[model samples]
Target: MKRKTHSVLRSRSGASITFALLLFLVCAVVGALVLTAGSAAAGRVSNLAQSDQRYYNVTSAAGLLADELSGKKVTIVRTREITTKTVTEYKVNLAGGAAVNANKIAETSSARYTTKLNERPEVPTELADYPTDTNDGAVFTDLTFLDTIAVKLLLDDANFNTDEAMNQSMKNGPEQKGVLRVLHAGSTDADPNVGVADPSSLSVDCLYVVQPDGTIILTLTNSTDKSGETYSLRIKLSPSINETESETTETLSSNRDSYTDSGFHETVTTRTTLTKTAEISWTVSGVEKVVSAADASAQPVETGTPIETDSP
Candidate 1:
């Protein structure tokens, strides 16, 4: 009887030990899963933050340019297209984290750039009178005041070449992936472009001039897969001019304001300036991406290829 009781006691003890082992194994697996999920969440957050930073970096630079142009003083006697030498020594500082520092000018030898300043009809409007003109019934006045500032910048040939390759790669193989951003957009509420839509569905064209008020245009663009259009922002070539002038900057500064000076009765009021946050965006790819040019250049023909037909 004593031996039988010992055998039963030993069986019960073995069962308890096996059950405890199973429970510990289950707890360990659950703990590992929790840690893994936490790590993945952290990684995703980090990536998103980085992406946001890159977008903001470009936008900030564009805004700075807009601010400068819109603030520039034009001759009150007769407004003319002012030429700014900012591009005289074009500079772009590529940050390690994909942030572009517009203020951080890069000194490059032998690279010459000529840029146009704000081109206005009449002189820029007074700051206090900006954004609106409450009362002005038609008197058939033939005066169109300059009320917006726009700035144009072209990606350098080297950068554009690499970007052109990427664009070609994506064009040939729609499977290829790329990024697009909206650098700056003008106010559409005042004067909207014919077909350009704001809060755009982001389909159709690679470049969308959101507003045609002469303010910043080409703010957003559809991805290659979506637009199926080769990027084109060249104003002139032999002179190496690509981006538009600073007309965009001045337009945005005076986006709203239409008053007859005659109505002012020569009050001699102080010029009111409107300060706005600069928004910048353009569909450009960079060589820093390091895509094999072969993917784009290896297409079939070479030599006699016309630049007008194909660029970089």
Candidate 2:
């Protein structure tokens, strides 16, 4: 009986030993699986961090490119300030007068009747189409006896179309004398020859922004100092020039009561505005490409991918 009990106890001890070994093996396997999964997760997280950094840098570079293109899109704006005021022009004209030969100078040899009087002076283009509004009286009169009456009427018209006359006429005037030689002269509401007047000749600058159709947001702002290569923008601007001329006639009467002669006065008005618009039609420059080879190659070599052979 004692031997049998000893044998049973020995058997139980062996079975316990075997079960302990199996549990040890199972624990080791589980630990290995956990270690492998944790290592892979850590590697994936590290790679993601580097990818994010490289992505930001690349995005920044792309933004710089877009800005470079934007900067090239430049244009000129023109602006003009116009000053204008209405003014009353005063002039006195003497009518129906014949040249009474320089106080007894012979009519046949009068300087006023000289051949030089027949020669007309050449005028600028602005004034070529416009002629004087007033008529100079003829050398001879109907009444033979009255020919000796009008004051020598020495015509001094050299200053008539000069700048001095133009500027002076703008100011106070009784301002002129002798178409008919009335002392106070006469008053005309408007200048008959205003038609040849200079045009507005004004310009203004305006900003044009191309319509934003795609709604592309420039999340990043970038710029370059390099003067971009010259290129033309096929953009168009509405440039135009317009000119106008108008004339009106009114009855003329001497302010002085002594004269009751009926005559017509002419008023000419002209306007011109000047601007050079052909500039836009030519070269509208903008850089083609600004990024240099060095710039592109300078990116971090291992930023997105870690190729370290020693990574555990």
Please write out the lDDT profile of model 1 over residues 1-312, one tens digit for every residue.
999998886775567778899999999999999999999999988766544443333334334433433333322111112222221121233334444222312221111112122342321211122122221211212322211112212111232212121122111211111223443353456556654433332222212221222222222222243323322221110111122112222221211122232111111112212122222222221111112423232122222323232212
Task: For candidate 1, report its TM-score.
Answer: 0.25
> Which ranges of candidate 1 are over 4 A from the true structure?
1-14, 73-215, 218-312
In model 2, what is the error at residue 58, expressed in angstroms? 5.6
For residue 139, what is the lDDT in candidate 2?
34
The residue-level lDDT of candidate 2 at 312 comes to 16
User: How well does candidate 2 match the true structure in TM-score terms?
Assistant: 0.24
Question: C-alpha displacement of 119 in model 1, angstroms?
Answer: 12
lDDT of each: 0.28, 0.26
